[model samples]
Target: MSPSWEDESAAVIAQGLRRRGFLTAAGLAATAALVAGRPERAHAAVSGSRAMPYPFTLGIASGDPLSTAVVLWTRLAPSPFEVDGGMATDSFPVQWVVAEDASMATVVRRGTALAHAEYAHSVHVDVGGLRPDREYWYQFRCGPHLSGVGRTRTAPAPGAHLDHLDLVVASCQSLGAGWYHAWKDAASEPADLVYFAGDYIYEYATDATSVRWPYTPSLPADFTRQTDTLGRFRQQYGLYKSDPDLQEAHRVSPWMVTWDDHEVFNDYDAEDPSLYQLRANAYRAFWEHMPLRSPQRPSGYTARMYRQLDYGDLARFHVIDARQYKTGQLPGSTVGDTAERRDPSRQILGTAQEAWLLDSLGSGATTWDVMANTVLFSRLDSDDTAGERFSTGQWDAYQAAQQRVIDTVAAKDAGGFVVLTGDIHRNYHLNVLKDFEDPDSAVVGVEFAGTSISSGRDGGETDSGLEVRTRANPHLVSADLRRGYLRCRISHDVWTTQVRAIDRISTLDYRAWTSHTLVTEPRRPGLQVS
Candidate 1:
């Protein structure tokens, strides 16, 4: 008899895995059982004693924190490099517990979640009914196997008075570029929350000259190619998450994450309908790997990520999605001052998002309004000559959209407006002006653009063209080419930002230091560099 369609599809997948040198005898058996759709085999895989390998190799994480709820994440991946994470085609029950202490003696919340094979055996438990502004320790348990413990906390209650809030902003970590020493350092810092602006995983092929090579069990064949399919993207995520240092950062604090271009493609936009399938695959993989809630899950190629997070009356976080709704860049140039660049119709954030942002800012709900943006929010002049030049990928490309935001903030008299940005792989402090053409214009707010975690390899304190670039743009206060993150402290009266820089990233053991410290006050916009 001819093979059924499902059998053929399974055969093709198995052959691809064999070609990639990832399919073992046990993996082949698992794939065949999944294709056969035998409930008996699926049931035995989870029920029989010692029938399945130990899962939960990817570690545990918590994200999307609320005053009374937090999402806990874990995956059943004994052999994570495999397409299905080396699990039987079945759903397994995973028990989770939240405690008030590290020992877990004082349990607060306990529940069970199903880890489904369709979603790579990943589990997301949205634990609620917890106390506000309290710390919790959580862990997961599979059949005879226990996952690591993770620490998390809830946000301050609404209208609650907060003396201060410490946050760490980080982004752009390329696994092949360098070591994750910066993440290790970030894990050690005292922070209330961690905001990962973008670039959680790069969709690039493996680097032949990777500093950390000969990975345990070797990298899958898919790593040799750029990620465009769901399986490949999943493997890429598995590879990055295998890093102990990055895992430590996630285990230490609850992360608020968004995506940038590298997560799918370099400088990709939603204007092209033909790439919808690719986007769908990437988006699905992203959702499966992240500790996101049901609402953030993707439907086909679209997902709504723009939302607001408030920390009492102290501050409000407006996390924006810049890449998904962005239009394609102007043809033939990436940096310029062309007429079309200034067109009002050219939008970076779509009309709906723009309106949402404006309305939220106009509400004036908190002492500080912070935009957790993914790109440089201030105009950056790259050309040293008399002619002005700007990166079209940044806010400079959509002057009208940027102007609308500025106008809203100014008109609404927003108490303390600040933009925390990442991307560009460098640190920058800019005085956001009402007019970029005139340096003497009123400074409506300030922008603290952070450097990468480990994207551009080892960098120095200053780049070759720093002096010229600084001279061209007077709004620029300082620029440092390094690998580190921004440590920010927000209070009712003052907001302090420390430009943290690491000594090196090519090597594992490196030192970190503060390159600059800047402060801004409520109702006052410009930075006072200390």
Candidate 2:
């Protein structure tokens, strides 16, 4: 039987209760038996092919880590088109192996999973019960094919003390606009983890015009570039995964991911199942291409990609799914007044996801709470005097829900909160406000919203509308329209985020420098700490 949120949550609670003897060990064992293990066919042994050859024909990738476990990913490409291209109709058995060394001499874990017809035969293996903060090398295997070598690291154990943690955060990568220079820089940065916050590939396919001017349309509206079909989604992943630079980044270190609008569509709602299927298909394609866990399989029209990963006691990573389970308001739904923005009825995170976030915050014991979520959670305005409202699609649109998250964390974790936001396609630093319109209200979190990887290229002068926006929102301390990522480093007491801006975009020589900086202190509420 498929698992429901409440059922899974109850199971987590039950495990905790069992540990405390509220429930018997025998009872817990029985429960485990009911919901344990992969399918029998997946575990059936592979006798031959000990000396597997030509690994990494496609590319390497990794994701979804915990203290002890992390998922490793790769696809076998006899031909990129045959495997991940979505053009082929056959299925292949993809094998995976994780080792302690770059060379496969010291093998630790090995398994075989089917690269199915629907998912373009990708492999996502959830490797569990391993050590924390340790590095591992992994590779994929097919009948006679091999994938490139990839590396991954598990998160630091919860409550363990450490001196430092480095993470690179980024989002909104449109394929047609430019090169992955931001990705190149991010890959080269000396960071322990790179959290791809969302929009790895746009759902739309562009044409020569989008390639030329506003030029990219994901294809023309009349021509229809990307397909809504499962096969098309698979092909989209293929196109994205085929990028050498992106693959190189995946090969370097572990990644934590969450999707935004473009992953599925501009605005999506979970309430409607059919449309939701498209999102699910997109999610499945993402999971297959990514290094997420295996059980992350899609159910009906949703995938459980949101979860927490702790890096010792330094930080707790909360990856959220802001797209799937949402009540998509109109495209540019920014409205006036907190009343419209704060309506409890208006949900950016559907009921279930909201509960999950609150519960994770309540139970987590990390020093820093870094939310790897999509969309700007801060109150931003493109116009101030123009008096245009906020987009109902952003976190600001669901004021009640965002406030609940802040209040929950504040009441529980007095250690301060740090949110890493994306999807606006522009860089911004905001002093997070529990009630944005009302400054007298609590200052709950500090946000570092990164610019896109070539998404918005209004590379002219500062937008006049933004000046009005700055004039209106006191919480917004800074904003920049560029394409780049944020390099954030955390020590025991201080947290620093350096927004590195690409000097020029869509070019290989685009230089980057620390465009801005923000510091956060323990127990302090917002971004004001210097």
Candidate 3:
């Protein structure tokens, strides 16, 4: 006989209570040491013992892959929910090995990194000197406990001839909304790398209407309120990382990650000094959880997130930071087009980033120049009435900045410029026009906006407002309201994008399918429905 829903819920709640109690006790004991200013002793050898709990609860990940290097990451969290992760203030040496095979018999590179308590015992080992465009298996050991093996690959040598590259684009995975069945499906794909555009963790408080609960019956105490402090943000990441499907996705392939507004607050800007401390805390936690190199680490509230990744001469991924340095949104009706929205001084990428992007695009090195963007690049009209409507949170809000980018792409004649976007919890395929207002404007590029992994719970095949919105914006070719990611196959001649979607996310037993296949060619900016 199966357990009833009430019984299952009760069990989950009980587990949360037990974990919370343990965290309270551990926190109190650590407070005394902190107050006394006692120095923490380094435990160089706390091997697997009966007294010590297993520390790889949050799983392991790899990201920021280069031609000869990749970053391997793991956090020591025996009790992930605790503020200290049930760890003492002492640091521990973690041994890491990269193997040619899944079995540990054939080893290539090995090193030991010290996991410090200041960074929540998270270890980021930036392994270098590996062969380019090769697969490598890595694992971690502290004392006697061994972590689950993770697979990562280095990028191809620069300008090396490559036939094809497979990548998965995903974003906006709100833990409380639904289960991550989409991520499980993504892990099964033949992907070289995964680009997590943004919104890795939502900052909203616990939702009463959550469809599924993995760890607890409701959100834990730290996650019951909006995530503002470092401790709360860490707890949020712990909960999100605990998902088996998410962990599997991370374990399978290298990831390229960036942040959206939800990582800090909903529609936040960097101009406000009052929110700088909060932003600082959020940025620090983001770095600790992700598999990023030290150069991308946060210094106070600022971090350099925009960078370029090359896949031989086949493709170039321009990982963009659209939110970090942007000016605040214009004050007025959110949907209505106002004069302030067109102000030249209202910047999105700011001066330095804009210059970098333009210069990178000018470098005609690769066949495909892909933008790993967070928000929609094409203008989206939300209101279909006589008056025009636009989202202030998107590129449409900063018309001058958008125009500059479009002009640069046209002037440079960038090859097959494609933008992979997330954040809006719906899929859209649109032709990026030189001027959104001109219906006959030349198509400068194409944008494939992927839906969320599980943001809006159990979304349908099509939204009610899809027809009106698509009609208002002629550049938009297709739209789907479902929870999933995009599988992109890139070659020198053509680029294909499969809009993969799951039937439902409310239940574990869900079906995934390719809803649409869109293709584009180099120097041919428009998308063709395949």
Could you report the Cα RMSD, in angstroms, for every candidate shown? Answer: 9.4, 13.3, 9.1
Off by over 4 Å in 2: 1-57, 81-91, 143-145, 210-224, 330-332, 386-388, 440-442, 458-461, 528-530
Candidate 3: regions farther than 4 A off: 1-48, 214-220, 332-335
TM-score of each: 0.89, 0.82, 0.90
Better of 1 and 2 by lDDT: 1
lDDT of 2 by residue, 292-393 (tens): 765567775778878777877777777888877777574455676556566688787778878888888745566777777788887776565646477777
User: Total clashing residue pairs per candidate?
Assistant: 0, 22, 2
State the lDDT of candidate 1 residue by residue for 471-517, as single tens digits. 88888888888899999989888999988888887765688888889
Candidate 1 TM-score, C-alpha based: 0.89
When 1 and 3 are scored with lDDT, the better candidate is: 3
Window of ten residues with lowest summed lDDT in model 1: 38-47
Ranking according to lDDT, highest score first: 3, 1, 2
The 10-residue segment of model 2 with minimum total lDDT is: 37-46
